[model samples]
Target chain A: MTDQASGSIHSFYVHTLGTPGTESLFWLCATLAVFGLGMRLQIRLGRAPWANPVLFSIILIAAALFVTETPYATYFQSVHIINFLLGPATVALAIPLADSIRLVTKSLPTMTLALLAGSVTSVVSGIALVLLFGGSHEVALSMAPKAVTTPIAIAITSQIGGSPALTAAFAILGGIIAAMIGETTLRRLGITDWRAHGLAAGIAGSGIAAAQVAQRDPVGAAFAALGIGLNGLVTAILVPVILHFLPG
Target chain B: MPEAFFTLLVFQLIGTAAQAALNLPVPGPVIGMFLLAALLIWRKSRASRREAHSPLSPDSEPGTSAASPALAALSRTLIACLGLLFVPAGVGIITELPVLSANALPIAVALFGSTILGLMVTALVMHRATTGGAAPEKLPDTGGQVL
Candidate 1:
């Protein structure tokens, strides 16, 4: 009886978790379910740095894939719909950015200079540390644009022969870490200006960090939004120029 | 709301097409934003000119003003869930664990060091710029606002 019960339970698990019907639909549902789980955790944790939705969701989804023996390719293929939204979602940023730009028009010059400096700092520092630490050339290249937003980071990474996968990882890592530690660092340093705090976090972390900043204050979000766009623009321009001048 | 959604889609489509045609390195959405900004600027200039022409109507709404329903609604919707859209790309990181694990020490150190350093320097620069070139003065507490 015990043997029979165990066999029945195992089969039931396979039947439910395994790709039983339309594979694409199954995968899509699974991805949504995982993301939803991540979102719940994020809310319950009050969106803490360690409880980041993206990080949590990825962990849950990855574990699910491991347990179900589902191939990464299969999961990716089924969730291309979600991936595709990244394009439109990026465009959506323009709206808030435009609003922010209007509000901060008078401070544009100072903000622009700060962002340019920050952008170059992000690239140079990232690549330098990667090389200093014995990372590969590919990792160095990927690390160069890791401080920017994902879509643009992916573009720059591909352009400069870095792994898009690695770039995404770095981008998310940078964002989460910055979101977690950025504000505290600024406060400790006695940096009270919202613009300074926003630019710093946004440049270091880009999209995810900006999102966290946005949750705190509108003014901070504006600077962060501006930082996200400007950082991407500057990094895109600087990486190639800097690489061209580098001694191989 | 539907109209606002349509406007967003149209702008996004235009942005994508521009990226493809120009072979731009920037993302399509960013280009779309540029186009949107240009359009809004033009609209605002036109609105102000018209207001100037009629000088009687001091209450004319400027183009891209907060009063604009579609822009306001759409932007709010997008901002509300801006964080959600990033989850997929973050999920992509799971597939690259091997490469990450291979360079675990270097990647971790580089990322952590560079991020902290970048944040510090950027904050300092911005602080100097915004505070009349004065260094930041230490404060007992910012009421957690800075965080």
Candidate 2:
């Protein structure tokens, strides 16, 4: 088929399948359907290290959007409902954190140091790598808090003149990467304690990866929750202060 | 589950309100989480104080008060599917493909290196604090198991 003919045919298909208001339903359904399929695929794959449901779903949905020539905004209109739940989901973290308070309080000092160090390392390492790789200043800034949770990472990205959207991508990317490699790496180093594992995942991975860690141990989840909250709080304060000292 | 969901939504509402009122940089849900944790802790303390005089039993944990069940259920449901909640935003990454692609090498290197380094450093420091800098004599096959 000729390029123009294929383009016209594609447009016709989309027009026939999706109308203005109805597109929201399609996109919402598409998002969930793809996500469900991804979940099933992960389960079928026996939850292999590389077969993460979130990453799988994102790839499937993004491909669907591209094929249909659908704008991201159209898809996001309905998907945002799922996005809105992130806040409540974050609040849910307090449940695990509270449940493990005794453990959290017992090693407050170590946890505090780990959180602070992890937060700073995430910001500095991201920015430094961006610069070293010849990325622009905004890219560096956007990536600065990539290790933190999405909402806070977005907030910090905007505060420091970076793109919030990019920050969200970076946050998700970091979370997936951390969730994928965090436990295995720790084990490679002979780190066995769930507390250390959870704290590391929480600080390095933020809430998403922390949730992954939460599946292992409630005590770990509690610390992961603490790591998320404390890392965000620390990064929020530290990013601006550190930027003030840096050249850019 | 529905009641538990609503209870969490209420806590989230208070958190969002707190964020707006205080102009805090931290996300509202995070603040709300702290608030919820505090309330649960206080409730447990009160329950514990009352339980102090009663005959001690193995089943009587401080935090397992009657008021806790609903929130516990809510938290479990939310956390279990936490990965699903993040999909919309993760899908948004496609919108930035141009930027991601252009800087793909650097972004990839940075994300990969920094995440690995961050995990190692944080884990090491935590291990130091937790175990007094003692290294385990033999490595265990962590298998990256959840628990």
State the lDDT of candidate 2 residue by residue for A1-248, as single tens digits.
56687678569747775777667787778777877787688679876545677888888888777777778877777678888888888888877777667667778888788887887888888999999989888899998988887788899889889999898898899999988778878887888777888888888889768867776666677778878888888988999998998885
The lDDT for every candidate, in the order shown, is: 0.74, 0.80
What are the per-residue Cα lDDT tens digits for candidate 2 across B50-139?
Answer: 877778735455446334577687777778778888887788898889999999988998899888888888888888887784443322
Q: In lDDT terms, how accurate is model 1?
A: 0.74
What's the fnat for candidate 1, on a 0 to 1 scale? Answer: 0.61
Clashes of each: 0, 2
Model 1 ranges off by over 4 Å: A1-14, A17-47, A245-247, B41-67, B133-147
Q: lDDT at B109 for candidate 1?
A: 88
True contacts kept of each: 0.61, 0.71
Candidate 1 lDDT, A1-248, residue by residue in tens? 36676566546546864554656677677767766676677678765555666666677777666655567777777678777766665555555555555546756777787887888788888998889899999999999999998878988999999998899899998888887788778778988777777788778898777776665655676678678777888888999998888666
Clashes of 1: 0
List TM-score per model, in order. Answer: 0.83, 0.89
Candidate 2, chain A: TM-score? 0.88
